[model samples]
Target: MEFKRTNMCGELRSQDIGKSVVLMGWVGKKRNLGSLVFIDLRDKTGITQIVVREEDKDNYKKAREISQEYVIEVKGSVRERESKNSEIPTGDIEIVADKINILDSANTPPIYIKDDDDVSENLKLKYRYLDMRKPSVQKNLKLRSDIIRTAREYMYEHGFTEVETPFLTKPTPEGARDYVVPSRINEGKFYALPQSPQLLKQILMIGSLDRYFQVVKCFRDEDLRANRQPEFTQLDLEMSFANQDDVIEMNEGLIKELFDKYTDYDLELPIARMDYKEAMDSYGSDKPDLRYGYKIQNVSEIFKDSDFKVFSDNTLEGRSVRAINFKNLADKYSRKQLDKLTDFVKDYGLKGLSYIKYQEEIQSSIKKFLTDDILEKLKEALNLEDNDLVLIGADKDKTVLEGMGALRRKVAKDNDLYEKEYALCWVVNFPMFEYSEEEGRYVSQHHPFTMPNEEDIDLLLTEPGKVRTQAYDIVINGDEMGGGSVRINNSDLQEKVFEALNLTEEDIKNKFGFFIEALKYGTPPHAGLAYGLDRLIMLFAKTENIKDVIAFPKTQSATCPLSEAPSPIDDRALNELSIKLDKE
Candidate 1:
């Protein structure tokens, strides 16, 4: 603590040899070689080798006692390493210690501070501070900071003003369940965390902010997935007087800048755009992975007169019979593997998966039910070839699309069919509303604020299911990086949308009264988008687990093992909020 540090552990090089320097970091590793001690000192930048000899008896004693992760400062002279390490930048030089100060000693860590340390995720989360010392983990955090800085630079360059919205506000009607906080000041009342700054940003547009952006946190009380967390960060932005084209163009430029800065891949301007309907019809997913091709082909017409009940019955009932041609994988999937695929589709509500193996001759589970004419039509429709396998899903359109979409990704991964380093596309013209069987009513697909397409506005009342909105999503590979829509600026249009969603007048007043009132005061035509900052970092870092990019993420059950959050509070605190726990 007495000596001021002059350099980071990882910053020294052979060029700086013979210069005396002071460095501070953790003891990454240590070894005693007879009268000499060798240590690898590590900091956030990287690691550097430190040498101490018995000639400096006091410092050598201290160095020999230094253990992994021990905090220390060293006054040393830089010298060329006897054997250079080509793997690291600081590998060419070593630090010869004149003095060693053990600032703080550390107990052996529960988890190793190495990238390849195989440990349970729960244990890693519990010992996150130690896990974060790994170079790989630190790299992700540094990259995340760089990405945020780049995003802010781009936003400012585009005349966007950065603004912060409230974290605690009233709960909105649609979207995922909110994580509400009991308001002690208001007694029984509660304040819900913002899901995205969706309504608030729209309000900003109404207030003539012109352009706004925020790197903010969002929360949702929803089931967790590999790529999702209950609490996450997003780069939320909105623009006044902007239509769908204006929003899309501005965002495309931002995306180009981000990729150009963080990745070697140069993105083409005006990225390819696909309609939602077309994406679903071809790839069976709105967020289609365009890196590989195993497009879903509709064979409903080809099976119209077939004796196969699964296909014929589905077609007659206005359902679909779709197939994916996994070319040259016919021999790869055995009967057991095919049965596993059937079970996979079952998860998506499909009764079963039917497949045809085209090897030397036709081999299939339902070939006996198909006549020669029907078989020939199917072969022609799917463009069958030798060693081609065709997997079929016959069910309602939604079920078929979901099942085939999952299968397509699995097949691509199993066969190593990725054809590009990055595949980015925009999905547009999404449905305005979809019927919710659970609620027995129509609900907004994106949100109630999304503006319906001009041509489809008339169908909002009569055929809400068929109406398309000016909504769009940016999809990278197979993940939906982010999505947004043009907002309805007119108060009348907003009311009509609420009515179409079956929101009673009282319900509207309770959930969106202020938003509607703001629309009445000269709200401009606006559109906005929010990108999942975590997902973006994952893509840039080339990591599969979302937790790897996050600093302190929760487990799948939404519990933080490190801090043990969402734990019971003192009775006095709950009593002050006029709340009581309900007995199970």
Candidate 2:
């Protein structure tokens, strides 16, 4: 190039007309019209139009050969465009080229660098570099960077010290499966990746750091989903001498700042709060989407004496019967569509779904089994209207809630029932432990280190099922953006929690001996929260798939199409680590 760059392709404007400028970027698009060649020069900021007249013979020849994604440099004078484009910021001006230099040539990209390109996700992952060149993808990445920077600034201003924790540590039981790495020096021993810096952050509080935070990577060898990845980032923080209110207040300020600075929407301070039990009973989900109303209502008592076996038997057996009224959607769903809904609930382990269509007449598949009085009572209980459809689930508590919860979201999405741009709520007072059928024992609902509700301490051994904890989750639009709890600063209380979880002395010593020992060193009354950075970015980016917010993300199968990781290792490498793969 003859000249050093003076401005980005997207930086030129009408005010810069008559000023000489040098711009460097990739050829976004090119068109030749015999006498003039027009090129859309693109950099990270955006794209700008550059024109080369045939009168400038040498530059015109070079512009004619320019293709999409070709790296180039141009020295030109900015001029007001003859046709102003209201779409782009740089549309009011054009760069008249006095010089053009192609830095590199390129073959055609496998995927188009456009937001609406309808290509397979696999293809996008395979050519992610090209995919990232799209303005939309770049915008998402840029926003992610801005959010992280804002988070760091907020934490620092709040007297929180940024800290780094180990990526490799001793393997511990509970939570999700860990991605383990064999220690070459230790032979058969392996080190597990940190699921979260839960233990380390608590120890920092004990170490008297007072306040600590980290924007770090964590790994979990778990099944993939739309909002899940094998490895992801988290904004983890812990504060000593902080209670539940303190933690919530600090995070609320940070969230408010982020939204106000980056988004057009303003978040109301001190977001709404809901009890965990109320959330589940009303919305059938711990992380309930509050943007729209389709609240699940418990109708078990109303149906206790009903003739319908599905309803009566479950109610009589201490199970549940829940109903959701999809207002004025009776005609929207036909018999075939209702049957499809039944199949959807079946996927959640419900035997089937029962519904009542209230159109000109009250009609239901189970109407024959119900008496007129029972039907009338049900209609009143659900507040059914002339054109409303009520879907019902009857089963064990968990099954019923799961089925109805899924149906609520699905129906809302299918019918375009979203009423708000964002709904943020805090779900508090979660159960400390839940029965794990596979383990035939109780496991921590949040984690073993969580402090139980003080009043429920006696119930830990007496009525373990009734014990609640000081845990809280921040749910936004049906997704759990983050969750945390007051830690068990008392070693004795922590031991009792482990006992309730049925962790034997030996199990406790092996898995959490270090953490328990650390607590003995006068751990402060501390609480912290860790936000799923990817999930938070997803919400801000308005993207359904988590990968859209991530620069290089794995596919649903947990494999990187671009790098093709998780491939077979050489035998010699395994031998160095004293490891061998089990061949079936």
lDDT (Cα, tens digit) per residue for candidate 1, span 58-162? 998898788989999999899999989999999999999998999999999998899989999999999999999999999999999999998999999999999
Cand. 2 TM to true fold: 0.98
The positional error of residue 253 in candidate 1, measured at the CA in angstroms, is 1.1
List, residue by residue over 384-416, the lDDT tens digit for candidate 2.
788998899999988999889999999999999
Flag regions of model 2 displaced more than 4 Å.
Answer: none
Q: How far off is model 2, as Cα RMSD?
A: 1.2
lDDT of each: 0.92, 0.92
Query: Could you tell me the lDDT of residue 551 within candidate 2?
Result: 95
Lowest-lDDT window of 10 residues in candidate 2? 366-375
List the pairs of residues colliding in candidate 2.
none
